[model samples]
Target chain A: MKLDRRKFLNMLLGIGGIGGIVSIIYPIVSFLNPPKSAEPKVNSLKAGLNSDFPENTSKILKFGRKPVILIKTGKDQYKALSASCTHLDCIVQYKQDTKQIWCACHNGLYDLNGRNVSGPPPKPLEEYDVKLIKEEIVVTKLG
Target chain B: MKKISNKLINWIDERYDLTPVRNLLQHKKVPMHRHSVWYYMGGVTLFLFMVQLFTGILLLLYYRPGEDSAFESVRFIVTEVKFGWLIRNVHSWSANLLVFFAFIHMFSVFFSKAYEKPRELTWVTGFIILVFTLAFGFSGYLLPWNELAFFATKVGTDIVGVLPLVGEPLKVLLRGGEDVTGATLSRFFGIHVAILPAIFSFFLALHLIFIQRQGMHEPEKFKNLPEEKKKYIPFFPDFALKDLLLWVVVFNILIFLALYFPWELGNKADAFAPAPKGIRPEWYFMFMFQSLKFLPPHLWFIEGELFGVIAFGLIGLVWMLIPYIKIKNRQNWKYQPLTILGVVAVVFIFIMTILGYIL
Candidate 1:
């Protein structure tokens, strides 16, 4: 079939428009998802020995891209939560005297259970599961 | 399918009038001539701006705006992230290209005397866009938070501080503190990503609307030619198709540059560290940088740096008010003060830029 001038131009425009959209979207998708090399491995990791984390003491450990607060309230009783505040992602520190997780930014607070107890935090700190394997203490994401 | 499409068109037309727009496109004509290639300069600049926008947003996703993380994050984006290298380099290169094309467009408009009468506001808006483009460049330069960028920003802000009374306040406002620290990074990042784009988009829309309302300006010679001697092409299909072809070509060039010369992630800035040697502004700012360097410490006890700054301000003022300065004259290009001044300014920029590199 022979294409007329209008039809030909319309076909060209349709093709160009599709190409234009695809060109734009490809970069955005690549940017958002990022390549595997760029993404930090955010899986479970060994925090330390159970003996290192004693009663009434808390320690901050690097867990992939975020900092995790590992606390031992009692013997063999371990709790782990992300140290980033839910409000602004600032690194939260454990106030030993208050026994609460505190974000210096905006005075945000989280309870021992990782719940947003007060201040500007809109959500609870992400909790992680802690387990003891022989002498090693391991932290993993909570499902 | 065709009938349903036609019915949908009819449905939309009932609510809003589309016929006038269709008619406008159908009847619109672009004058075709030897200098018609310059007309595509605006379209190319627009395309480059779009490229900058896309790559800019992509970079924004991964960019961390802080004194501590800014440099590291950009390094990670360029070196660690997949295709982050391409996105970043394309963004940088396109920014340079956008400024380059804008100058070409301004010159083409100047030589053709397209800014004459009726189109003065259009010219003003175009000038505003050019300024916005330069502002985008300056603000975005410091986002990388590298050694060169750090010193360059310090030098840039120092230049701003030379202004009479508002100098110190404006410097503080831009730097956000006593010096170029983390505060400066945050301020520049916000201005680069959010503030400048918002302001530039407003002027860009006005510039575009003016162009559409007035149509493309024909050179004086073309306008003076007999109607029967002139040639024209429809704006919708013919001219637009050519514009698309040029855009495709430009896209290829942009990608090629991005792939071949991936942008570098220089050393992270340390405020306490000594300013490194050979630090300079981007190529576009080299002229001003060189000019400032060329000045003596004092000229007859009056500060030479301050004198240079004042001179630059006066030149900028004259540039912005060119249309008003020549408001009485139109239709002739020979011996025009604006034209002569334009040529001299271009020459000054070229000479200074070369000297900036050499000296």
Candidate 2:
């Protein structure tokens, strides 16, 4: 069957219009529901025993290069925050007296709870789910 | 009362003549032939300014610009205010983009003869707007009061101190003291929110007015009009709509990049931590910052800093004066080698900016 010039042109326009719409709409929808960044809740994996963490201090424990700020708040209770600033990913340090995470790059100060206090930082440090399993500390990266 | 209404209507009708403004602005019709995407740099700059203004007001709702309240206020916004973090990011990024596009727009206009005859005032006002924009960046950069802000301001303002004779006074004027502390933050905040915006709006209105009065500069071929030809179109339904559409596209693109990549802010500045190894100025200043590297300690006994400053001032002066620089038929810049220099200059700036970041 021979396609007429008008029909061919209509077909071309229709294809082009659909392509344009998809190109614009798909990215927007993908942006709105971006791929999940955090690990799914799972059996908490242990980092090390209580003796490894000293009193009134935190250490950056590496779980597959996903750095966790493990703070031994009390003898039994431990608090954890991501070791990076949410603003730009500069390493954050644990503040002992105030019980906050501090970043040196921008003077970004974060409380133990991972809340941003000051500077050009836009977001708070991410907190991790720190569960004491048996005698070991298991810190899972939290969203 | 009836006579008064008639007289008022007549007065309003006479002064508010839409035709002349529309005739001159004629917007899209005026430009006639802007084939490249780069031609929209000015419009893009305008678009980012709108973004900055909108998001800035949103930030102002929670931001308290002072020593004691500043840090806490930012904390409150991040955790307490709904979607405040997102708004702040958009505002900061948009401010940077505004400066970026303004530079591109200014240079493009220079090489294209867009700042030519009857448009010199437009050029001057545009230059002033650029200055106000730098002021906006300087002021806004200090508002958060973190360590980076503290040290960056200290180093940045100290550079001003290297000037001969006026250096000390200028630094004091900027910081309100020997160091950049609370006073400097407050002053910068005031300028960012109030004075700079007011001045920018004044110049922006004038710039738009002149752009309207002169329309767009044509390539040499189209400078002369044929007898009785009226090819110009209305700005509102036609060009303004197109501008708005393109603006929406740019906004969406910027927001997407901001969210997905999420430009990193440095860790909270630790006033105690040694300054970051290689703190540098924002992208727009990298050229001048890098330019300083090439200069000698002193230009024939003149302080290097002073001579460097004067030298840049001269470059800017030349840039602004380009439209007045006469050339043969000069209309077709597409083939001109001098135009090639403008492109090279822009590329060099980009390379230096990236190098500054990497180094």
Per prediction, the TM-score for chain B is 0.95, 0.84
Candidate 2 per-residue lDDT, tens place, A1-143, comes to: 35698899999999999999999999875543323335434534577898877878877766543556788888888887767555334456777887767765445677767777765345666677987778888887665
Off by over 4 Å in 1: A1-143, B1-5, B327-334
Clashes (candidate 1): 0
lDDT of 2 by residue, B162-242 (tens): 667888777777776555557777778877899889989999999878876666666554556573553554556776777
Local distance difference test, per candidate?
0.82, 0.71
**Model 2 stretches astray by more than 4 angstroms:** A1-143, B1-28, B34-39, B224-233, B263-265, B268-272, B294-300, B325-341
Q: On a 0 to 100 scale, what is the lDDT of residue B53 in model 1?
A: 92
Cα misplacement distance, residue B297 of candidate 2 (Å) = 3.9
lDDT of 1: 0.82
Per-residue error at B153 for model 2, in Å?
1.6
lDDT at position B233, candidate 2: 48
User: B1-359 in candidate 1: lDDT tens per residue?
Assistant: 99999999899989998987878799889999999999999999999999999999999999999988999899989889999999999999999999999999998898888887888988899998998899899989999999778777876776677678988777777877656778888888988988899999999999998888889899888999999999999999999999999999999998999898877778887653434456678999899867866666456765666777889878887777666774444557557666777899999999999988887
RMSD of each: 19.6, 22.7
- Chain A superposition TM-score, candidate 2: 0.64
